[model samples]
Target: MDTDALSPLLSALRDAVLDGDARGAASATERALGQGVDPQRLVDGALIPAMDEAGRRFENGEFFVPELLVSARALKASQAIVTPLLAQRGGVVARGRVAIGTVKGDMHDIGKNLVVALLQGGGFDVVDLGTDVPPTRFVSAVTNDRVDIVGLSALLTTTMLQMKATLKAMETAGVRGSVKVIVGGAPVTQRFADEIGADGYADNAAAALALARRLMASGA
Candidate 1:
């Protein structure tokens, strides 16, 4: 396919994702494949950028959870078409492995759920630990699964303190350096994340996905 033919398909993918059209996104992905376009071209060129714009809007207050979920679902739809192809072709490394859960003492899950969806959509393998996950479980997951990132969610001021404890546990188990720790939720802040010695903090799901990508790239 000529570059000119590829341009409209890319635009279609971007607009479909911006509009949160999952069916449209999938159709665009399949069509791109039929056109002999590189799968990575669709993923890196269109899908990631669309989600990045969606995240920017979410952070800026122009989009909310509903819009973010819509875009995430759209990305997942497109990813469904691309993943197997990459696997069969070989030499395609997984983006990363992520272990995510609400911290011990937190029962809220809305934000964590969104983060999980977006992380998978971004091509990361995710293990959802449910709400109120304990530090011991996190340590086991890291050591057993060889997790690349540990994402913590805490909705209450009280539960937020567990983030520090969780980090301590990782250090105690000697797994702290093997994985990057990222924290989020309504009560989480960059200052708190720093105090807890976390590797990153995101204000929302899109930001969380971006943070995961960065940490993966940097081997954090």
Candidate 2:
């Protein structure tokens, strides 16, 4: 394995992530790591760029939400291997802590799962509350986990209304002001997020990570 011939390995990793092929991405990551390619190099060179490109395609209507979610999952598969190695090298940087869930009555997990992968890829410790998460569970997770951001997801118009209920529950539980709430999902809109008093709104997982970082940076 000529370390000088890293281009093929790097290209394979990038293409795997872009194709949303989890096993392929992970296999490529393992080969890269075994060949002594810098883990940070693979992350910066392959994972981030793949996700960024996915975001661009999503925004341009060349790719849909599900495709982006699949790509995020693939990035996460490779990220899992790269992260621990980066940590051992004392090179891993955590952006923030996040607790995210699809609101109660919304059983959609793909979007929330995508956000989970993206958050971890962005170097945040994420506490995933899973789909159809109740308001009590959201509050409990935030209070127990000490998360920097709380994210609500809803894939249906009816389920999006649960975001408001969840917010109210958090306010009643005295946790609303303790953390920033960001909302997203198919039916979610910026107007709805603002009306519900959410701190931020993201149309997709990549944007969710950016929003979480900004919310945390704002001291929320």
Candidate 3:
């Protein structure tokens, strides 16, 4: 493997993802692989860092939903090419597992989807339960899927009540203590999270990712 060729390919992959160019990302990923770049290196060195930078930009108000959505698309494209290879080689190890969804009665998923992408990029295995998810589903994900964290999203003030309901369900099912619960959405507040006995709250996707990592570090 020529070090000179490898560095350029990796840089191309990173640039494509940061620019939200999905096709360019995939093409660059494939070229890098063909040139004998390590799959793990692609994931750790290019994909993860690019997403981290994207998250940073979003946190700093330099990017918004449109930018994040496209960057996530590019990351997914690159991951589609490299993830399977990494899996076969046992080179990928999840930092943790998270189950996330929009609480019942809420059809909104834009924020939830952004959190999922950022969490995945941050090396956690995320289970996206989509929109309008009920308490039972959250319970089942905890009891059966064994996720380390459960994220509840509610874009509407009305649907926010479902976060508390979900927490109650977890307690009743004997899974509440086993996982950390985080809440967020346009209408959610840290006070609401505390009132509902949640483990944490985040205002946006970047903060959510940081909250998750902190939770994992503290053994939640």
Candidate 4:
């Protein structure tokens, strides 16, 4: 575990993720763990940076959905190894808990799925509610899962109204103030988010991760 030896393994893991080499990423993680590298270090130093780079590439249009998903799969490969060790040692501290879903009446989930992967890579414990999710289901996630943030997604103008309805459901459940709400989708806008009283909005997966981090930092 000397500095020189540690540096290369970390680099290998990072490169594997950025290159979308899931098998290599997993093998690197295993080798690093066997070499006595701290699991948390692997996560914070290699995995996080790799995902951040992937997100950057995505935002710059240098990476598409396929590329992003591949990178996420690589991260997942590493995390599969690291997570259990962290759990055993009580070393992993999740940034936050998030519940994400497409609002009711909108079956589109491409954007939501992308955001879900990025959020997971960003170190948030995400509960993916899939597409055409009911507002009541979101409310249940907030109350039962004790999630810190709720992400509502809609690809249609018609379905966007469901986002507002979802918010209203949270209000009715008296948990509106307890959790921060973020909205996004192809047709979603800042003005629409403002009108719906969302805490934040993001146009893409990278922005969603950034917005989630900001919301956590601001205690929103």
Candidate 5:
């Protein structure tokens, strides 16, 4: 399909997903597939771009929690439909493997989820450990999954400390240098990342993608 023709379908899919209309989103996804839409395009062109807009709108105060939730719901719905197709196409090879999670005591997951979406869009194989993940869990994932990078997230200042401790644990476990570390969240800053010996830090999801790619390239 031409870009022009695909734009509206893509938009509709975004709307449907945001509306939490799973059936409608699924219908739209099927239609796009029938029209020979590339599965990657559906994710990168449609879903990820829409979520990026949502994130922008959120940062600008044009979108509130309800709006963000709706948009995320929609994107996830569309993802459900398209991801399987992408999987069938020999599964997208990640730029690198990453194990990601919210540090212990920090239950916030919105930012983590957004990062995961953006990472997936950027072609990373992400093993998400979810919210309130312990330091040991992160280490185990790194060891078991052989991930190229480890991303630690914390939304609260109190919990942000967990990231540092987690890094320390990695060192004690003798796997600190085995993988690059990236950290982020509302309370995190580039300075803090440096203080924690993190290889990189990003303020938001888009920047996270760029940083992840750069880290992978430099490490490789």
Candidate 6:
């Protein structure tokens, strides 16, 4: 597809996602592909950029939960189509490997999901451990997955403490130095991350991506 024709379709896909029209987003994505648009173009030009806008809006308070959720859902819908293409192209070559999880006792997933999307968009192979993950599971993922980075999420103040304990467990397992550790949540802060010996801390999903890239580049 010519850039002119592709640009409008890509914009449409972004609008559909931002408008919370999941079906429209899916249809638009498929239509773009059918029109000979590059799958990578769809991802890089539309979905990732749309999510970046959503993240910015969220940080600026221009978007609320409903808005962000709609955008995320739309991105997921588009990803459903693009992921297979990427896999066929050799699994969307990643910059590095990462393991992510919501710390033990925290069943929340929204923050974790956003982090995953941001990381994947930034070209990382991320293994999501889902919610309520124990410290040992994190250690095992690091050891078995040979991940370069570990990310922990905890939305509740009580569960945020688990992030530190998980770090301690990683230390005990002698894998703390093997992988960089990052922590975030509604209650988490850079100070807390520093106190707990985290390699980095992000205030939001975009910052998370930037931090992950920086850490990985530094050979952390």
For residues 29-83, could you state the per-residue lDDT of candidate 1 as single tens digits? 9888998998768766787688778878988999998998888788778877776
Q: What TM-score do all the candidates reach, one by one? A: 0.60, 0.62, 0.61, 0.60, 0.65, 0.63
Where does candidate 3 stray beyond 4 Å? 1-91
Best by TM-score: 5
Cα deviation in Å at residue 41, candidate 5?
2.9
Candidate 5 lDDT, 1-220, residue by residue in tens: 7889999888877777656576787788889889888876776666666666777787899889888776666666667676555444333676888899999988777567767867877788889999999999999987899999999999888999999999999999999889999999978999999998999999877788899999888973
Candidate 1: worst 10 consecutive residues by lDDT? Answer: 84-93
lDDT of 6 by residue, 37-108 (tens): 987787778876787788789889999988988777877787778765654542366889989999999876
Identify the superior model by TM-score, candidate 1 or candidate 5: 5
- Higher-lDDT candidate among 2 and 3? 3
Give all candidates' CA lDDT scores. Answer: 0.85, 0.83, 0.86, 0.87, 0.82, 0.86
lDDT (Cα, 0-100) at 165 in candidate 4: 97
Give the alpha carbon lDDT tens digit for every residue of 109-210 in model 4: 645766776687678888999989999999999999999999999978899999999999999999999999999997899999999899999997778989
Q: What TM-score does structure 4 among the candidates reach? A: 0.60
Which lDDT value does model 6 have at 119? 81
In model 4, residue pairs whose N, Cα or C atoms come closer than 3 Å (at least 3 residues apart or on different chains), thus clashing, are: none
Q: For all the candidates, what are their Cα RMSDs to the real structure?
A: 6.9, 6.2, 7.0, 7.0, 4.7, 5.4
Taking the tens digit of each residue's C-alpha lDDT, what string does model 3 give over 46-150?
876787788789889998989988988898888878755643532257889999999999976645766776687677888999999999999999988989999
Error of 1 at 4 (Å): 32
Ordered by TM-score, highest first, the candidates read: 5, 6, 2, 3, 4, 1
Candidate 1: list runs displaced more than 4 Å: 1-93
Best-matching candidate per lDDT = 4
Clashing pairs in 3: none
